[model samples]
Target chain A: MKLLELRGLAASVDEKQILNGIDLTVNAGEVHAIMGPNGSGKSTLSNILGGRDGYTVTEGEIELMGAPVNGMSVEERALTGLFLGFQHPIEIPGVTNMEFLKVAIDSHRISLGEEEMNTRDFMVQVRDISKRLELSTEFLKRFVNVGFSGGEKKRNEILQLMLLQPRLAFLDETDSGLDVDALQVVARGINEFRSDENGVVLVTHYQRLLNYVNVDFVHIMINGTIVKSGDAQLAHEVETHGYTGLGEA
Target chain B: MAVPQPANTLQGDLLKRVLAHEVQETPWLDRSASKSLLNCNGFPFPWKGRWQYSDFRALVEDALSLEGAHNALQSSHDVDVRRFDQPETEAQTMEFGSSDGVGDFPLIDINGVLFRSGTKLSSIAKTGSVKVNDANGSVDRHLMSIEQDAGMTVEETFKTGNRVVLCHVRDNAKLEYELTMPHGEGIGYHCLVVWLAKGSTFELHLASKGAQVRRNDVIVNVLGENATATLSGGWFVDGSDHLDSQVYMNHRVGGSHSEQSFHGVVDDRARSVFSGFIHIDRNASATEAHLTNRNIALSTQARAHAQPELEIYTDDVICSHGATTGHLDDDSLFLLRSRGIGEESARAMLTKGFLRQVVHSEGGTSLLNL
Candidate 1:
């Protein structure tokens, strides 16, 4: 069954149309890569899917698990298993990473009517995930993303994704600012989070991240709409040839 | 001979009468105190007093509509002092006003210390001492002044009308003070007098959550040698509230330290003003002082003004002050939004982050109440 679907979706920002018409669908456990140059409306599409503000969808429809997510808040969508790993993670001063994570966890659990996780269980889980993501325990004690190196912030997002275990994850240039080692760790974190019950859409300008996370399909987006769709090999082709010839096909 | 207009004469008489009345109220007020009050009254309307450029006085006076008295106090009068020790309703003494539907907690004992939260009323002063807790706590025996002096902690909260009165800190003592006032109905007056004794240490924290019209006047006196004072404040002014804070710190002796940092975010039609002065007296050598005020205007109509002034009379002193007023950083906003956080959520997060500094600085469960 299709776990996520976008049909005839159109979106715009500041009264300027960005996503003219978009149509796509993804089943459970599928990894899809969206490749386009800057201003191809790639970021706009990802943002609209996550219900970002300033973008109006003048036409079309979007459904997650057969439920329309357009009216849901960012937190509501997050609780419903949608995750957006930002290209530039926010630096929240004074609030420690551990504190934010616990709040997010408790928020979701409370919504689900589950018992709040005690400190012992929370710390044990945080330690386990930190080891998998190669994050220092000291990092959790510091304020969220404050004064962190570029790679560290990106890895922190993945760590959150792994812990939250969202249903559909949107990776927005998660590969940017990451070294090969960091990229592998990020990919490993994503792989660990991925299961038959979840899916991912990787939005990137480069095909390097695709090398680590095998893509079930690749979609080319341009001028606010999907121009072409193909297998994982298409990512390598675009990486070499760029946007040329692909438009002709 | 041309006669002065009755209106002008009435205004002058009113001002003189106010000064005269206040002087009578505080018989202990020294020569300097009397001169400061007169100077504040003589300060020309909309001219160069501490509130010269701020619309605080007009806004508050119009909102509260003072009739018989410029100051009023509301006391339950039953005076249940025993309730100061427990967290239960049986122990609750006062309820100032509603707070986000989270009813205010009454006076409680923390580690044998007695503290009651600030009420939402103006022109009132209530006093109690930690001296009562001396048996169970190690508090300073000499720190019993109604106003902050050296060697004590003062926690007071209130909602007010148009004026805040005197606060005094004594010489050569260590002091810590906290003020938390969230927005509520009506206008207020906050007249404060802080006196610091020779060789004393002091720290103050002030936070404003949501108040429609708030005007505060503060005077701090730092006397004697080796004295230290630090003041920090934060305000998240939203809705249509207007807030004003004016502080005057006097360095009367040598070898003193005074530091102040005030920050705020004003949204909607809200406005905020912060003016701080650091005065170093003659012969007050080796005096070190710093004052900083920063603000973020969140809306097109939202406005803020920050002024940090330094008056130095000694060549051996090190004093610096700065003020900045602007909106949130656009680049930072873009950075957060790029991460898939909606623009609105991103803005809210950053605003909350800015205020979190004040909350986290306290470094305790006390912030949970905030």
Candidate 2:
């Protein structure tokens, strides 16, 4: 069954249309890479999928696990097993990373009718995740992304994805500012999030990321709509010749 | 949470003024307090001036009444001493309004510091005199002694009324005390005085809620060549309770250092006021002083007012003061909520963090038990 299904999903902000008619679907356990030029509505699609504010869904429907998610809020969508790693995550001052994580974990735990983790157990779990992400313990004490570098924030977002274990993850430009080493680490983290019950949609402007991580399907987005779709080799083809070769596909 | 008791409702200034007199037997102290009462005539209703933003007058007029001031005096002197944080068994203590000797701490006097509390209304008559003004351009001062290691806690419930007064802490002595006004009655005061010796220190921790509390604390540190003093407090008021703390600190001698910090969180219709002033003398060279006042307004009706002033007479002295009053940051709140924390829980977390800054600085971590 499709983990997320979007049909004719048109969106607008302040009377300006960002996304036209768009149709997409991802079944469980599939990795999809979306490549598009800047302002080609790549981030807009991710935000709309995440139910972020300031966007009016003028038309179409988005279903997550068979439930319509078009009217849900960003937080509501998060609780519904949908996670989006932003291109530029917001920096929150005075909020420690650990405190933020505990609240998120406990929230999901309560909804699942499970016992909430105490401070000691929560710290242990956070440490384990941090170790896996190569995140230092001191980073957990600082404010969330307050003074973090671009790569550090991207890694932190993946760290959150690993902890939340969302059913569907939307990574928006996660490799924009990463070096080769950081890109490999981020891909490794994503590989960890890949499970039979979950799916990932990596939104990027270039094909450099596909070098480190494998992509099952490569969809080229133009004018807010997926204009072409092909297997993994398509990414390599698009990398060399750009979208010029897929003309009128 | 609700207040445990009902508020008192007495009318006019005369009735409340007379009630203050009858509660204390110290005729001298009675006379000293009455002079300040004259200023109450033109006292700006908490809503009448720049201070008019919060409806403090309505709170005083509606939520306050003539409570048993004498009962408050009785409780102050009789609180169980063993329950105190730092108990002193041997110290020269003077008996005044504090019946239980709440500030009785050991080694304070031997350290060349004197602390006194629970002095009777009569004992203040023999001490020296102090002249100070209330908010309404009225000057009121009193005479009191330096009772070493004598202290008390004022645990009064104000149903509809409050008690206002002036205090004097003499030089070269130390005093540490706690003022806990939880619920029921409201306590209002015009001015408080602290006359520090050349090398004395004073520490005070105040926590109260469920009433309208307004107190003015004035400290005049007579720091002899190498003297120091520290002042710190935390005010956590919730429900319909209102608490105000006004402080004035003066560094009169050179080579003296002073630090003051107070934090408040006002919830519901509760209001907290923090007005502070720091003065550095001309000859007080190499003097270091810092003052900070922070408040969090939790509800729309919840109010906070802060005015931090710094007066430096010597160019070499380092003195700084900052004041901030606002609700918790929405971004911080959103960050917590995104993690699944409810709005209420997020507010509590921030409030606790705000208060923890002061508690940690006060050198007494065990007091919070958190």
lDDT of 2 by residue, B66-105 (tens): 3221222332232222211122432322122221211111
Model 2: residues >4 Å from true position, as ranges? Answer: A13-17, A35-46, A87-99, A117-124, A136-155, A175-183, A204-209, A219-249, B1-24, B27-185, B188-210, B213-238, B249-265, B276-298, B306-330, B340-370
Model number with the top TM-score: 1
Query: How close to the true structure is residue B267 of candidate 2, measured as C-alpha lDDT?
Result: 82
Q: Per-prediction DockQ, in order?
A: 0.14, 0.23
lDDT of 1 by residue, B171-252 (tens): 5445555665656576554544556676666677777755556766566778668877888878877678877787888898
Model 1 stretches with alpha carbons more than 4 Å out: A113-115, B1-8, B18-49, B52-202, B208-215, B218-229, B236-243, B249-259, B265-272, B277-352, B360-368
Q: Write down the TM-score of model 1's second chain.
A: 0.67
CAPRI grade, predicted model 2: acceptable
User: What lDDT tens digits, residue by residue, belong to model 2 across residues A2-30?
Assistant: 88998899998777899888888998999
Q: What range of 10 consecutive residues in model 1 chain B has the weakest lDDT sum?
A: B103-112
Clashes of each: 40, 40
Clashes of 1: 40
